[model samples]
Target chain A: MSRADTAGSGERMKVVVTRNLGPDVMPLLQERKELDLVVWPEDRPCEREWFLQNVPGATGVIVMLSDKVNQELYEAAGPTLKIVSTMSVGYEHIDLQGAAQRNIRVGYTPDVLTDAVADISIMLALMAGRNVRETTELVARGDWPNTAWAPYGFVGPQLSANWVHPTRTAGFLGFGRISKATLARLVPFGFTDCVYTSNPSSTPNPAADAETARTYGLRSVRRVGLPELAAQSDVVFVLAPGGAATHHVVDAAFLRGMKSTAVLVNTARGTLVDSDALATALRERWIWGAGVDVVEGEPHVGREHPLVREPRCVVLPHIASATIETRLGMATTAAKNLLGALFGEAMPAEVQM
Target chain B: MSRADTAGSGERMKVVVTRNLGPDVMPLLQERKELDLVVWPEDRPCEREWFLQNVPGATGVIVMLSDKVNQELYEAAGPTLKIVSTMSVGYEHIDLQGAAQRNIRVGYTPDVLTDAVADISIMLALMAGRNVRETTELVARGDWPNTAWAPYGFVGPQLSANWVHPTRTAGFLGFGRISKATLARLVPFGFTDCVYTSNPSSTPNPAADAETARTYGLRSVRRVGLPELAAQSDVVFVLAPGGAATHHVVDAAFLRGMKSTAVLVNTARGTLVDSDALATALRERWIWGAGVDVVEGEPHVGREHPLVREPRCVVLPHIASATIETRLGMATTAAKNLLGALFGEAMPAEVQM
Candidate 1:
């Protein structure tokens, strides 16, 4: 008797993957005989109408940050949409209320991309502070003519061990998972003090926050006001979420308070900072430099962008979670979440209301 | 005028800064009116004739990597060349033997660039392993024409946190300050084991290494043979020095021994690895990917470079110490070293041969 004859045929379930995933991750779903997977072939964002049509008969949908999962999508997905798993940590695009009301489990990959994002954040910070783009452009543009030795040419801020002395400190605007991860990366660079401002939450616990800081080897991690954070920090990181509560948190006043030798890194969200204010600060030498991943308005960012035009500003395409491994892990997790919900199992990483 | 009258003119010494430094750093040196500084006016490598002509009467020379401080150049400066300070951590171009023979103290910037290099190493590793370049190229080249959903299109490796389980270990080719710092960054991501291969001269006492590992919250820090490091490590880093003792340390044999999911990072030097072998390994899937900063023949690197053609290879233009702050610090330190040595004071970071 064949092995196939020994195993009884189970009912197959339809799953729609809304975006491209990793090659290795696809085999995991493809190998399952009881699952039928429909994959989109394009590399860019999927059309809303195409998704609306395809998702109607599907048991599960796997998506990414570009795809918005709202009430319309949920309604189009109908009763068969048991799971909606996004291959990203943040699910702001997903209508949580719709999922909750429909009794459909919501799965979003979190923590998976922490290292990748943290890595990019530090890269952007270093690149922006160091004038990497300017130097690279100098080489690329073949502006080598008249190149001669001069003092104070192409110099960027230094993250010296001396900067972590008792008098110096690192600051954060909006402390979260990525900020903590970034702090862990900066610790070895001799960062001694950390002052951060987090949004006032209903659940207030100072001891837990203190304990978390201690665990991460931070000498001090105090939650302070925005003004205090700006004044004391040698390097200020904007790592808060993008929403009405924290929009333009780092304005002109905060930038002016920073040390002239200080650096600014924003990897969380672009709107968390006032780009025009940052340009003025850099132009006026209020702060040393700025590194930004997400700009106030991205993709639309052109040569005319104020930060791009500024020599001290380092602008990168919003690619914090762009690493292959992290993206793949995110895809796999998303796939597994969809499969779990479809097969009547607990979703691996579900976002509850 | 009264203070100037009190100060003596003989205290002023002739100093030639070989490269451009930060304006802030220069002000610090300028604060010492006792030093007569001759600063370079351009950002390129200094002309050899200009250096020779200027050096005859100077007490010290602050140089960059582009400037070769050889025996001939030293003799031209005569008895006046008391110190030769480089604005870089690596002093290979500087003739250590000649400096030692002349009793000329040398100063180099080290330890300062450790965090920056370590940070870049992690960036390259993530970028390569995760297919950052290829995906970025895809987006930049406008190859992303359609917006359809496809499974397994642009997925890359994600050094999953799961790999840092008790059974898994992260290995290093050379365990030095930067390696230790890199390990510290990886610990929070769940890396447990820390095995490294170092030269016999720098081998740590087994007990001390273990204790250090414990202090850093690592499961263990053990020394092993090259083969063992290759066989047991989940991710092997080529962080050893470049000279004769460790050339092509990571070759086909080492790559063959690594797990298929493992990654290799080389931020130390290009000669430490075999580029051809690495390209072959990546192509054959012997190992996952490689992140490299230094190429065997750098500056001459082009699009046709073997690693550049490989999708899994992430090549950076030797930017380990490219951070603005670190570079500025190095330049400042070099300037300080020159000023201090010329004026008969202690060098801030002198290289003890």
Candidate 2:
């Protein structure tokens, strides 16, 4: 029975929220008297069976990266589900084909997270370049008391360009919005040249690339093959989309081609980089260090993981977009997307199926 | 009498090097046949007695930050010492009055290190804001395999300006070259306004401040009092000159007035921040977090240190200027400074006593 029938009011549609959005954004969904909100009680990822059971008879669903929006979910929701809103930029977990076939619109947050992820990317680069992980570990382990100062001690390659190495080059694995934002940050660090690789399916726009170069005051910002990018870049940022075709793109050969002083930052996907190869390269001094926000099978990544064991590698728990403002923005966008789709209005950020 | 005279070549003047200047730059001084060089062989700090014994008849000395240039050292070197060249920006250890009385020129490496220090300041800011130290420790301790993903698990305040906070304000304890470079960096991250403190001895220039604001595209870059800076800033950066006047300037009262969401960064000298007060502030959540490169009594900072023990604080081993390019530049400058003062040439970066 509809909530309207039981309470003697107008018909209220059911909306399933996989997790409770915080006070700042959750009320947008909760305060909608026309909607009956069923939120997952816990802060953590909900159990699959619980989600499958709770999604029944829902007109809309608000999800996170941890949620799986597949055929099973669509079948459970039947014809009532109009939209599946996710509080993330990536929708790899969602079964887009099934959602499309079911005519369920999918909304994913993107632009709001660009600045936050870009900020973390630079943070990772600096942490890795300066040996923050190892040195901080030393201090935490109470080893700093005995270590005397040395002139060349703890010195790493400079990120900023100077008279010694006046030209600094930055490379992006996937030059998308987040990568471009990262490039903007690098401009102030004295990066003069840029290179990137986009999906092979996308056409190159030399005019647009030249415009971007001019906009950022860079010497060049061009498309380059993997080998050339590996060879030329002083710092290589992996900011591409993650999936089957791009898996292990930064394998042994790519690591071998990188300069000994070059730093590798992977804020995109763990699968794009070969963790074993990166570990071996760091151990062998083939590359200076690496800073990664995501791992191949993250949250499951332990001390035994190759990248985690790599002394020079800095691994964060996939927190590139965990900033308060970005998360709140994402949550609010997801809420708005859900509200829009359920009430027969234009979705704020609907994905193409 | 010199080594060259003993070898039947030419009379040589002795120069004492407190530490090895490394192979890349040491040759700049060693190649000069007119000088007899006495270098302390170890990579660590030179012993006081070793420095004293070697400085007896030296014409010049190349020192590091660890070396204390005092009355005793000056008396040991006697009238033969023409210059003291240090590979550091801070020269508080040097007795300026004694050096001036003896007519000994002082040369310090400054501008070369500005970028390196600025880079680390930003790194510390991000690290502290994002809880890098704690999260990375969780991964290091092998707890990640069991931990499930949660929405609010690692959320911290965002560093970027957003719709919620339309204009981010950055505060500088002392706005000098490093602070300005840091401000230039923050501009790309969407920081809209800046406030800083000038030396009490200098007159405030509203015209110059307005020019800086225009140059950086900031709303304002005005000089403010400590209390206002503490209250108004979203992120407060302690970049002041460290000595008696500036010591403990960011103590309890300043910390109390700060927003709980504000991040405090100290890439300047350690003494400018009161460690115990900061620890209390962090522990009590009076501030969001702190990222510090220097500490009140660093190198001696153990696990027992208040700031070191604070979970929210990111403490580095005083490596603000520890980048290869900057260090090499500083070494080259120190070497050239000695060469210049000894040979009647203009010193590249001499400090007038």
Error at A299, model 1, angstroms: 5.5
Candidate 2's DockQ is 0.77
lDDT of 1 by residue, B1-353 (tens): 23333332355667787765766677866787766788777656788888888887666788887788998788888876678888888788899999988888899998877877877666666555555555444433333333222334444455535422335578999888889877876766567788999897874689988787887787888999888898887777788878878888888898888877778888888888889999999999998788776778666556666776787876666667765556677777887787666555567899989
Candidate 2, residue A46: Cα displacement in angstroms equals 0.7
Model 2: residue B33 alpha-carbon error in angstroms? 0.6
Clash counts per candidate, in order, are: 24, 0
First chain TM-score for all predictions:
0.90, 0.96
lDDT (Cα atoms) of all candidates against the true structure: 0.74, 0.89
| Per-residue lDDT over A1-353 for candidate 2, one digit per residue giving the tens place of the 0 to 100 score | 35334433367888999888899988898777888899889767877889999889888899989888888889998887888999888899899999888888899898998998999999988888898887898888888888887778889988888778899999999998999999998888889999998899999999999999999999999899999999999999999999998999999999999888899999998889998899999999998999999989887898899988998999888888888888888889999998777766677899987
- C-alpha-based local distance difference test score of model 1: 0.74
**Candidate 2 chain A: worst-modelled 10 consecutive residues by lDDT:** A1-10
Q: TM-score (0 to 1) of chain B, per candidate?
A: 0.91, 0.96
DockQ of candidate 1, scored on C-alphas against the true complex (2 decimals): 0.24
Model 2 steric clash pairs: none
